[model samples]
Target: MSAKRMQLFAFFISVTLIWGCQLEEQEFIPDVSGIEAEVDIRRFDQALFQLDTNDMQPELQKLMEAYPELSTLYFTHILRANDPRTAPDGPAPYVKGFLQHESVRNLYDSVQVHYPNMSDIEAELEQAFRFFQYYFPDEPVPNVSTLISEYAIAAFVYGENDLGISLDYFLGQDYPYQKLNPRDPAFSAYLTRTFNREHLTSKAIQTLINGLVPPARQQRLLDLMVNNGKKLYILDKLLPYAPDSIKLEVTGPQAEWLEDNELEMWAFLIKEDLMYETDNRKIRKLVDYSPHSPGMPEEAPGRTANWVGWQIIRAYMEKHPETTMQELIALEDAQGLLDASRYKPGR
Candidate 1:
């Protein structure tokens, strides 16, 4: 071939590669400007902490009035305190005791400093729920409320219309979670690394998604993967602007590792005959949160199988563009979905 022709060929290949990458990165973000969804964020933490200790009873009454269901959940479930209305000593003693605790007070103060204003979070959620409405127009958007759960819980969805976010759980990676409670296994470094503002919105949306998606009935590894993958897919649609690392609840390096080893990971799964493995203990190692996927390299993030399942779902959706989100979710045959995906990793 002529030198000029060779140069043109190389340039064309580069342009095609770049265009393909740009196309891959392109997300189909629907126009949510017309969606009439709004996030009603209540500062429950601020209100409860600012209550007057001197006149605690009426103050508690006012709080209960302001947040009837949430207040009850706070007392009974979150704090594990006696119900204020039915307790022998009433709400004052519990309120005063909680306020007077040195550790709890300090935690609340840290939460305030870290989250001085939740306007940014509120706006992000507003956009997410707008997308939610765009996808599930019949479903009602939940009211959001913030609290200081003292590391007890990160986020919770109450019934169909209320979502609570625990501010203390998201106090960033430098909050010394282990130092605060070394005995608690849940405060491990691998998990707490995600305890930051960047993960707040994604975590909240994940909680909501969990409530919306049906629980997996089959106990096999593939069923769990597809079930969790469906949830992740829905979450991706909801938080279209969130980073994949945040949605996957992994560090940047971990996310990179998953992307680089996609084919290897899938091969490992198939070679080991783990796809149909129904042992709960065996399945948990691959799908559950941990330092790394057991039996895989240290670089392989926990929930590695879940990420693969996500790719399968992505492949299926790409191959069958006519399948709607609702339809994809409604189709429960994991094996059939995998077969239809024709999911060749490098392709």
Candidate 2:
């Protein structure tokens, strides 16, 4: 037989095999590429607002097309343009192949806060979630107790004196929505009630990122991560504060770890169910590492008065015993916060 003829025969066989292979449809997983969840909602929202959605990067466009789960990037671009300068009336002002859902577009304007605030980001995220809801309403809503646990986890990471939003906002609500629970474990309620769904997803992702998810609600997630051992936590804002190694749901034969630190802590902290203690930890941890002890500072430009001051106030109260939580939180000794090392242990 001629060599060219043999090559042609081989090529036809290869084409036949390629055409004969059956490909399974991939399950829908939320898209969260290149986004960090630990960021205060404001900054996260700001970042979204800043991306030049009009950019003609072919790869980024391909990424978006192949990974619609990350549609949040487009949303962020729309959010930036939502302003009068960009959109005199509304978002999606003139863009084609863009989405501008009501949940995100009409998310009420945010208040100007001096400290890190999570509300704007949270609200906008909730609005963003409407897309997910549109995509998967039948998928189970995250457990409320699970949500609270995750919220608490995020609050702890935010630390004291951060202008950033924390779980306290929800616990203080006058009217909380229906409480939801996971079906597994003992089938007990995770959150007594759910005041907000955006908060729910945010906290859940935060907890997962921080290794703080509650055990009852985490079993299925853990099992999935263990089996597949791929990327686990979902919040882009919270990812910056967390370590790189995460617990992902297992599938397609992957290596698994015994536990995911961020995820485990989220569950442990939630099951403990002590907001005040969690708050105390939030304040204390910030002070311990942020400025007082000076192990690391999260904000790059170095905002000095955040967690350090709150830690001093909380420590003073813990030592004094009679200090009220409100008074402690409201304390205004900027110098004292800066000089937290004076009160550490022996001082």
Candidate 3:
């Protein structure tokens, strides 16, 4: 086998390594383990079990009367409080992790041991959230991933930096950065910094969405959004609500250029949505403050809909189920997907 094939083989095994570890169980807590990490699990899960949820579900229903996020908010916070160590890096990527070891099996195993109401309630809530695509957007997420191309997903969601994970990378180990530093007083202080929670500002909403959905689901979800029309998501317009901390400028010609290519449009939108909060400034800034993330200098692939290339490859795989794992993984990147010639950027 070739070098690329070896990597694919490793990735497949890597995925298989996590089974009993339900990464999605990350209702809270950081992704990393082995460092008194399991304590967060015990404290947080038990704390939730002890909450005064007395007939609160229906009352809680009043707030979320509209969407699952409404309900997810209160519950996740309950989890966040007890598991005070994740942030900046966020917890969604960990959510996609497999239950690699049995350390936390007892956490789930004991769900019924204490809070019998939880065993079913947790699954019920996740089920309700399954209908929409959840990703990171400045707005309250609709259940899709904002990490468009595999790059963002790989780093932010999959926990792997294409540049390779480094201590220098500010994101801070992606998953553990989210769980907060158990050694810091700031973790407790930072948890309460949400004075603006109720208003549900663009930034807050995006944070919640990422916390709710896993990267694996988000990846498949990028497909769902593209399959749904590549451009009709009504939420796209509301993203400007986020503060202008991040900025960019996309000239009209670029917009028009992108308009002609729906696939590019799809890819661009997903790409932009993924970076709603970052300041890297690599993507083309189509709107004020918000730019096509993965920020760069000028013309990049698919201005509006970046997910198109990814989806096309997915479509191909669906049609050709016989394709090898190596073949499929090779088509995972932005350039790889585009080079397939299926996506004609600025066409």
- Which predicted model would earn the best lDDT? 1
Tens digit of lDDT per residue, candidate 1, span 75-192?
8887766765555576578778898799889999999999888888988999998998888776779899999888889999996757999999999999999897888878999889
Best by TM-score: 1
Candidate 2 lDDT, tens digit per residue, 9-81?
Answer: 4543444445432233242334544333233243333333334656524434554464343233333332343
Provide TM-scores for the models.
0.88, 0.21, 0.24
TM-score-best of 1 and 2:
1
Say which prediction, candidate 1 or candidate 2, comes out ahead on lDDT: 1
Clashes of 2: 40
- Put down candidate 3 lDDT per residue, 108-176, tens digits, no spaces: 433333333333322322322222222222222122211111111111212211011111111112223
**Runs off by more than 4 Å, candidate 1:** 1-25, 83-88
What's the true lDDT of residue 176 in model 3?
A: 38
Q: How many backbone clashes does candidate 1 have?
A: 0
The lDDT of each candidate is 0.82, 0.30, 0.30
Task: Provide backbone clash counts, one per model.
Answer: 0, 40, 38
Indicate the residue-level lDDT of 168 in model 3: 14
